[model samples]
Target: SQQGEEDPQALSIQEGENATMNCSYKTSINNLQWYRQNSGRGLVHLILIRSNEREKHSGRLRVTLDTSKKSSSLLITASRAADTASYFCATVTSRLDSGAGSYQLTFGKGTKLSVIP
Candidate 1:
């Protein structure tokens, strides 16, 4: 299923604004990662684009990928409050009986950002 599912599970802005999130998946993937967790802290690797690559950025974050509209969007520009947390989008295929080519990561149900302050 490509671990797709991220559509405003929760969000509350304040400290500097700018925070968009959206992720959807189903199948077909070689690389597509974006992680950041800062509540209890421990999941940070915000950047990884492959599968032909569409768009990608770092400092301030800015990612975009269409894949024929499979969906993928995450932009956090002037945001602060430590940039809140919870923003995942991992997708790396290969496992249809051990193809040995995947990175093994399927997480969604994120987008819980709350940079109030």
Candidate 2:
């Protein structure tokens, strides 16, 4: 599957600590997206980094992508208990056979993070 696999299926850390998660994909992609999902809530888009971009930052979150290695990493600094959630990495690949602007998005099983205050 072109979907990425997240490392350390589960993680636990204290508040104010930094949390890092890694993802590896099997094929080429147009972009990679990170999403956060609370226990019973829907996913919320965290960030999106294009294949042409190597790194990006949003508030306390930082993401890095290594196209050559087909991998990516997400880091959350000064994590809080509210940061606890399931994090997923989704990869977008263009569909060559499909008409213009067609693409497919694949998501990983996700990494569950728990932050203790």
Candidate 3:
């Protein structure tokens, strides 16, 4: 029952098709970030969108945040086999313990995406 839980736990699509993933959180956030991880590799940062922003794009990836619904979605256009990985959404929230500009990050379980060639 934690914040930042992604839906459609797994996804499968053909190469050149699009892939979409969604994440939902429970509390207010300063910003949200997306990351991708290969089977046996570390996570790679994908994109970050501020709470004030509605949508953002980087290359073939498009991210949209809906503060009103406390949810966000990631869309990958023309997904490739190399893009097969687990994608996660993390939320950044302000710390209440007077941590002096420090923040807390909570990540979703992630959606496993498999791109078929």
Candidate 4:
């Protein structure tokens, strides 16, 4: 089953603008993380918010989590054209089989952002 689903799907904006993206998921998660991916490249870790954390910030990025609503949001302040990329949210889910237990990580569809200078 799918876990996280990114909202907006895609976004476009001019340089120096701010961007906001959201993620919604099903099931309990240990933590939620945000990552950025440029075209044809690996994902880069941006920030992580634990289930108990309400909000966090790093540089121009800010993240908020609401376990009650099973939702999270990422906000980018003063976005630049260089910031153009795909953003994804990841969550940890676990499964038990045959009295054994294992954990898995799932990522959202991603929100693609295009920034024009």
Candidate 5:
């Protein structure tokens, strides 16, 4: 299994402001992804950055990955109240046991963000 830590357990910001969150992992990973979860729902995949990718962007969201440092950051611009949610970073790791190989997706604790209008 893989493990990760998210900084700043919680955050509060005003609508239209930018929000940033970070994640750090302990093991080698194939890729890193960001997800957003509303109050009572499933997580929605925001973006995926492969180990070889240094940065990626989707709309107003931007993600940066530093494999050497085993860390990643997600930035959201012009955030709105709807953006208020729990953000989590998931890491994909693969391991070989015996003659079989398996992949795992482990998520960090999560960052609870509140957007105030």
Candidate 6:
């Protein structure tokens, strides 16, 4: 099942400002992950906080999880032009039969964030 659908299809902000995005999911998950996808580029992992974890942060990114409601939020502090990208939240899950590092990550459509210089 799909997880983490963000509100607001797009958002625009000036460089140095902060950006916020919210995501809501529909199922029980092992972990929730956030990623950034630049225009015409691959998605990069920003942070992954397990269902057991309520909050996590990395550099300028802050994320919070509320399993009770199956929702999460992302905040980017002091946004940069470099931060202009589509931010996605995904579900990181594991199946006992897999031989990989242990999880398959599925991403949502994402919130397109534009930061102007």
Q: The CA-based lDDT of model 1 is what?
A: 0.83
Per-residue alpha-carbon lDDT of candidate 6 for residues 36-88, written as tens digits (9 for 90 to 100): 89999998989989899998888889999999998999999999998999999
Q: Which candidate wins on TM-score?
A: 3
- Across residues 1-117, which tens digit of lDDT does each residue of candidate 1 receive? 437788788889998888999898887788788888888778988898887889989888998988887778888988988887899888877776766753567878688898888
Rank candidates, TM-score, best first: 3, 2, 5, 4, 6, 1
Residue pairs with backbone atoms closer than 3 Å in model 6 (clashes): none
Model 4 lDDT per residue over 51-117, tens place:
9999999999999999999999999999888999999999977765525677677999999999899
Off by over 4 Å in 5: 98-100
Error of 3 at 81 (Å): 0.2
- What does each candidate score in C-alpha RMSD? 10.8, 1.2, 1.2, 1.6, 1.5, 2.1
Candidate 6 residue 94 Cα shift, in angstroms, is 3.9
Runs in model 6 deviating more than 4 A are: 95-102
C-alpha lDDT score of every prediction, in listed order: 0.83, 0.96, 0.95, 0.94, 0.92, 0.89
Candidate 2 local accuracy as lDDT?
A: 0.96
- Measured by TM-score, how close is model 3 to the native structure? 0.96
Order of the predicted models by lDDT, top scorer first? 2, 3, 4, 5, 6, 1
Residue range 1-117, candidate 2, lDDT tens digits: 648999989999999999999999999999999999999899999999999999999999999999999999999999999999999999999877887869998999899999999
* TM-score winner between candidates 4 and 5: 5
User: Candidate 4: where is the Cα deviation over 4 Å?
Assistant: 98-102
Candidate 1 structure, TM-score to reference: 0.34
Q: How displaced is residue 71 in candidate 6, in Å?
A: 0.6
Candidate 5 worst ten-residue window by lDDT: 95-104
